[model samples]
Target chain A: MQVATFLAYLVAAVLFITGIRRLRKPGTARSGNTIAAFGMVIALVATFLVVEVDAAWVWLLIGVGILLGGVLGAASAQMVPMTAMPQMVAAFNGVGGGCIALVALSEFYQGAAETWVAVISGLLTVVIGSVSFAGSIVAFTKLQELAFTGSVVFPLQQVLNALIFVGILLLSANVLADGAIVEAVGAPFLSPLVSLYILFAASLVLGVLFVIPIGGADMPIVISLLNAFTGLAAAASGFVLGNYALLIGGTLVGASGTILTRLMSGALGRPLGKIIFAGITATATQKGDQQEDREVHDASPGEVGEYLSEEANKIVIVPGYGLAVAQAQGPMHDLMETLESRGKEVLFGIHPVAGRMPGHMNVLLTEAGVPYDKLYDLEDINPEFDDTDAAIIVGANDVVNPAANDPEQDTPISGMPILEVEKAKRVIFVKRSLSPGFAGVDNPLFYDTEKTMMLFSDAKQGLQEVVEAVKSA
Target chain B: MEQLLVQLAIFIIAAFLGFELISRVPNLLHTPLMSATNAIHGIVLVGAIIVFATADDTFTIVVGFIAIVLGAMNVIGGFWVTNRMLGMFRPPVKRVRKRKG
Candidate 1:
């Protein structure tokens, strides 16, 4: 029976690895997901059969628990729209953290061996799991609009978090040292169970503090970081329980989530340390030395169509959060098709940090049935923008801002990489107003008089007008 | 000590494996991959199940039940949502061309 359980976990791990590899491309992502889910089913069935249970009530409770949970998860997954995916993912991840935290609690209470291994594992699991659970809730709330999406500040937020961090460490050490090493710590001033509860509460508060100060723009990284935390916690619980499946699965999650977090932080051109510790909110102070207002050239949709229609020239489309907000993907696709039909080469220039979350624009474009080949990532498309005849901007503000290129003014997004649309021969901008984007910084490209033109309209309306104007011209 | 060391070896290898596997995925699929990994980590439900099946007293039963429920939610919700998100990424169905049928 022990051999069978270990073999099953090994098989499951192989499946998970293959599944991840298959998810690398658009063609195999769905199949990869199926493979991973199949592995999960195998792991689940194996767990149920091997885990010794004497009580029938426990079985009943498990059935009811699983049935209830499965229904809720399925309903929400089916119903949540594409735009709300980030928060939905966050909420589910939060539940996973909460689940492991409770498992750790049960292990601690059971007091199997009370060995140093068990004690340390339980303490680590409880702390990390609680932190992830609470932090994920904050992420979900912010992304889902249950709370404000901007950074929340108080006096010495970082200092407060640090103090709590120290307290959690002290409590954790007490759990380890007093329980095993020291015979009696001053006549047992604090009970182990009560001290654990206190530690749990403290970690929960720490999780909230950890996420609350970070804003919506950094949510993808935050979510990835929390997912990694939950994974590490789950792995720690595995140590307490001595379960191979938990150990392997949890470690896989921890490592992948961390890599993705690092990738996303690099895409944002911000250090991971600054994002987490400094809490670089959208409200960061901007130096006044670089403020300049130039004459704005507002163009018409008719003019945009006419420009796009100009004889067989290449054009690049840059989509951002505004495109998602305006629901302009379908129209954007229509425009792409229209330009393609006219023998003009149209390529999509996708910035890594274009939308609210990682791959936010790609998902929208894919949903709209945009071909995978036409999409070019930042590195590939940035150079091509210089050779293109026209660059069309729809609703995105900061991702396409040339201000990122300017060295003079130290704006919040100063060092971040941006879509070099300003390099295109003619720039057609579409927007409702001259409002700053999520970064809360004005785009220098807009105020430029050289070749940039703004349509000054809603995204969907602007795109539709351009399509109409193109058809007529 | 030996047992813990074995578990540590298993953990280190798994982490390295995860890092290697996740790096292969493209930026375009990051969100879907994120959701999918979210589902994969739902393996914690297995841990919850262990807690539930072996629960002895009232405290164990109560905490174990909560673990099962939350774990089940993560497993079910994470996989369901991931599949749903991935569903949006599929290619449009193409009509087969008739060969003089």
Candidate 2:
């Protein structure tokens, strides 16, 4: 039975690797998911078989928990739209953290931490798991569009975060030291429960503060960070429980989440640490005087369509988060097809942080039946924007801003890489209004009359009208 | 210390293995890949099941119950949602399946 259980775990681990590998391509990704789910089922069944349980109430609790989880899980997946996938991901990952924290706490109650290794691991789980849970909840809220999605900055926010980090470490060190040496002296060394609770509370507070000032578009970074935290926490839970599956599985998640974080931050033309530590949006508003406003010409969709119907070498469409919200990808694709049919070369240029999630615009455009080859990432397409005849920006602001290109001013997004749509001979912005983007910085591209024009309308409406006008022209 | 060594070995091996495994995913499939990995990590459910099954006290039972609930939810919701998102990425020809009206 022992050998069989270990074999099951081993198989599950292999399957997880296989699943992730197959997820690279659209053709095999679905099967990869199924295989991984099967592995999970086997791991779970083996775990239940190996653990000795005779009590009927415990069995009852386990059954009830599974039933409740199954119902809620199915309901959420069926109900939550893909647009809300970010929030759902945040919320579910948060639950994983909360669950792991509970596992650590319960093991502590069961005296599983009799050894120093176990004691330290248990405390680590409690701290990291609590933070992941709290941070994920904040990320979920920021993405859910429930209320304000803007940054909530305050005086000395970094100082407060540092203080909280120090507080968490001091509390954790005290608990572990008490469990290790002070217990030998036998003077009611420490209430493990009290210290654990206080530690969890402080970590939870830190998680909130850590994510509170982050704006909506940056939630992807926070979600990735929290996901990594939960992974390490789960591994720590493994140490508490002496379970190899938990340890291995959790570490895999931690490492992968970390890699994804670096990839996402790089895509946005910022370092991972900068996105997390510096609330650039908050500070940029304080130094907003540099953007001297200039009047922009308002062009009708008919005029833009006439321009597209005319002789143009190349046109690039840059879609951002607003494209997702407006459900305009389909019409945008129609416009692209129309443009192509009229003997014009049309391509898409995507900024790394163009959408709320990593690969947000890519997945969205692909779902709208756009081919992979036409969609060029920032580096590949940045040079082409200058040679292009026109660049139509659909409800995006900061990614195309010239501010990122200008390094002398030291603006919040100064070092960030942006789509040089302004370099195009003629640029058109399709937006509902002239509002500042999530970065809260003015985009000079919208105000430049010689090279830029604003099509002040909904993305879908603008695209549809433009497509119709092109057909008529 | 020996036990911790095994744990550390498992940790490093899994990290390298995961990085190698997931690095090939195309940018277009990133959303699905993320959701899929999220489901894979929901393997935490196994730990919750073990804890809940072995727990003795009422408080432990309560904690185990909550953990199991959350773990199961994470696994189920994550996999289902990932599948739904990936379902949207079918090629143009086969994207439209026949509907029984």
Query: Each candidate's lDDT (Cα)?
Result: 0.83, 0.80
Kindly report the root-mean-square deviation of model 1 from the true structure over all alpha carbons.
2.7
How far off is residue B97 in model 1, in Å?
A: 11
The complex in candidate 1 yields a DockQ of 0.69
Model 1 residue A3 lDDT score: 81
Runs in model 2 lying further than 4 Å from the true structure? A155-163, A177-190, A279-284, A290-293, B22-25, B92-101
Top-scoring candidate (lDDT):
1
Model 2 Cα shift for residue A251 (angstroms): 0.8
For model 1, the stretches where C-alpha displacement exceeds 4 angstroms are A178-188, A279-284, A287-293, B91-101
Q: Flag clash pairs in model 2.
A: none
Q: What is the lDDT of candidate 2?
A: 0.80
Residue lDDT tens for model 1, A393-441: 8888888877777998677888898888888898888988877877667
Across residues B2-100, which tens digit of lDDT does each residue of candidate 2 receive?
878888788888888766665644556666777777777787787788877778788888888899999988899988988877776655432343342
Sum up the clashes in candidate 1. 0
For model 1, which pairs clash? none
Error of 2 at A328 (Å): 1.9
